[model samples]
Target: MHSVDKWIEIAKECKYLPENDLKRLCDMVCELLLEESNVQPVSTPVTVCGDIHGQFYDLMELFRTGGQMPDTNYIFMGDFVDRGYYSLETFTLLLTLKAKWPDKIVLLRGNHESRQITQIYGFYDECQTKYGNANAWRYCCKVFDLLTVAAIIDECILCVHGGLSPDLKTIDQIRTIERAQEIPHKGAFCDILYSNPEEVDTWAEFPGEDGFWGAPKVVFQFVHINGLKLICRAHQLVHEGFKYMFDEKLVTIWSAPNYCYRCGNIATVIDFKDADNREAKLFKAVPDNERVIPSRTTTPYFL
Candidate 1:
């Protein structure tokens, strides 16, 4: 096994390691994640973060603002890669951290983690460009397939990348599904990583996509029947750092500051304490003045 410290150093610099080394790292981490259940259970006194979307510098800023690994028990609600310049760095850093401190961190699979989605978005191309081959990307996908779909905290809060699914009624149901595979087009697995709740009383799909429209009442019934106090998710981008709905029973937290580097939105992380207390720590996007953002001519095809 390679040293996790070395990978951490490479990640701190936001630099990609060699292809062979990255493949080794991915294989090692995949072995560990394969042993985890679909619904990973976590205890409280932990911090929950939202979509990262490959904003590496912002992620570094997040660690500085919200506390760092091993010291902070973190449950990252996915979207770790895609749509930013440093997908490889962002994901490998998180993967290295997981390998180093598996007990201190929980990595849930996001919609972008899938091969089909990444191919359409940016991760696959990013990998080909950065590594000169698709091997590293393939290895990472193996790890993605092993990631858990949801996490239950303190037996009261349900944490997932996306909102609740109509097909899901209990946390046990989340665990029963076989998780080590590609995310299906339409199913509990896909829903767990893509569903979002509608803000209005009247339900409507997102304007140009086959989207889901869920309500506060839907959230209430799901939590009530399952004996959950809250549902914390991060699939949708809330302009505000965080949003509370249904009288604070469900919350959507977004951690990617200045989403896509243009959304002009702030980010937040929720610290879930052991005694049922929740506190949100907010932060702004790191200024990108020093970075040269190129024009969209060479941008990924999905954009």
Candidate 2:
């Protein structure tokens, strides 16, 4: 087995790992993820981040802002791949860190982690372009299948890629989901990964999407019934980096700053000092002069 530390250095430099080494890294991460629960429990002093959509440089900036792994525990809520220029390097770096320090890093599945979504978005093509085949992508998808769906920080704050599910009222119900396959079309599993927060009176269908919009009343009820103090999620892009709804009962943290490299929006992460006391650390996109931009290609969202 290759040293994860060395792989981390290569990934940070925007270099692709050899296909065999990448496969080994994926297998190592899969073993670690399989031991995690569907709703993993995390301790305090952990930083909660939102979508990372393959902004590799920005992710490096995030580590600088939030502090590095092992020393600073982190729980990434998902959307690790797609939409950016370095999905391969980005995902591989996270996988390497997880393999090296499983206790310090927590990766949760996002709506975009699915095979169908990646194929539609950008990860699939990026993999093809980088490695000249889909083998690396397949290996990464296997790791995605093993990722936990949600995480509970100190057993009080619920962290998920999307909002709550109508079919599942409690966190325990979320734990019962069999999440080792491709995301489903419509069900609790799909809802947990695709839903968004809204101002409706109750659970309402999200127009033009496969998920639902969780109403404030419904969200408050869910948190109260489950004895949760807060729900942190990321799916929508908030120009200010993060947004709180339902009187702070739920929060949306967007970590992909200057989204798509043109949205001109900032990014933020939640630094949980202890579970109750937390601070929002905001950051901007890495300056162009500081990093090398890869050759341009047509991204799905732009096309």
Candidate 3:
């Protein structure tokens, strides 16, 4: 068995693990994830986060602000990889934490978790550049396949990577999805991961893809029918780090600060003290002087 604690330390430093260690880590986490349902159930006193997008330093800052896992439970609503520099380290750290403390954290699938999406984004290239092969990327994708599609916090707040899907009505519908594969082009599964909340009167087609842009009425209907108090999702960039929509019936949490390294957006996570009482903890990206930026051919080291 690999020492997950050691791997956590290494990943926090923004260093990729050796090929063997990474493979083992993936295998370990995969076994743990395989037991999770498509719609996993989580308790409160948990920190709910949005997209990390491979911002490893910002993720570290998030831990600092919201409290670390096991100590402060977390439910990360996907997009763990891609769009940022440290996809490998960012994801590896989370995987390690999951393996070490499965009950304390929940990781849901984001639209970007798909193999096609990662290839088009940045994760595929990051793996190849870091390991001189696609093995690492493949291993991570396997974990992505097993990642839960959505999570319910304390049986009230519905958490998904994207917004409401037109094809699905209840949380049970989400539970029926076979999530152990690459995300499909259309249908409830795809829509759950790709849809977005909009201000329109009803559900609208999201341009260029299988997702939908949902309106306030759509959200209200879904929440009412499902007996849900709120729908929490993350897919769009909210410069404020978090945004409440449809009269707080739904919330969009964005945890990647200064997205893409220049968007100037603050990151935030929701800390649920209990099922009823929750707080939004906001944080900024780690300063350049505080983090090590690795070169294309070198491991990261403190400046």
User: What TM-score, over all chains together, does every model reach?
Assistant: 0.93, 0.97, 0.95
Per-residue accuracy of model 1 over 51-137 as CA lDDT, tens digit each? 999889899888977898888899999999999878889999999899889888999998889998888788999888878889989
lDDT of 2 by residue, 169-213 (tens): 888899899999999999999998899988888888877665998
* Model 2 TM-score, all chains together: 0.97
Task: Provide the lDDT at 3 for model 3.
Answer: 86
| Candidate 1 residue spans exceeding 4 A from truth | 199-211, 289-297, 300-303
Tens-place lDDT per residue, model 3, 179-268, is 889999999999998998889998889789948999998888888988889989998899999999899999999999988878888999
Note the Cα lDDT for every prediction shown.
Answer: 0.84, 0.91, 0.88
| Candidate with better TM-score, 1 vs 3 | 3
Per-residue lDDT of 137 in model 1? 91
The 10-residue segment of model 1 with minimum total lDDT is 202-211
Per-model C-alpha RMSD: 2.3, 1.3, 3.2
Q: Sorted by TM-score, highest first, which candidate order results?
A: 2, 3, 1
Provide the lowest-lDDT 10-residue window in model 3. 294-303
Q: What stretches of model 2 exceed 4 Å from their correct place?
A: 297-300
Q: Using lDDT as the measure, which candidate wins? A: 2
Clashes of 1: 0
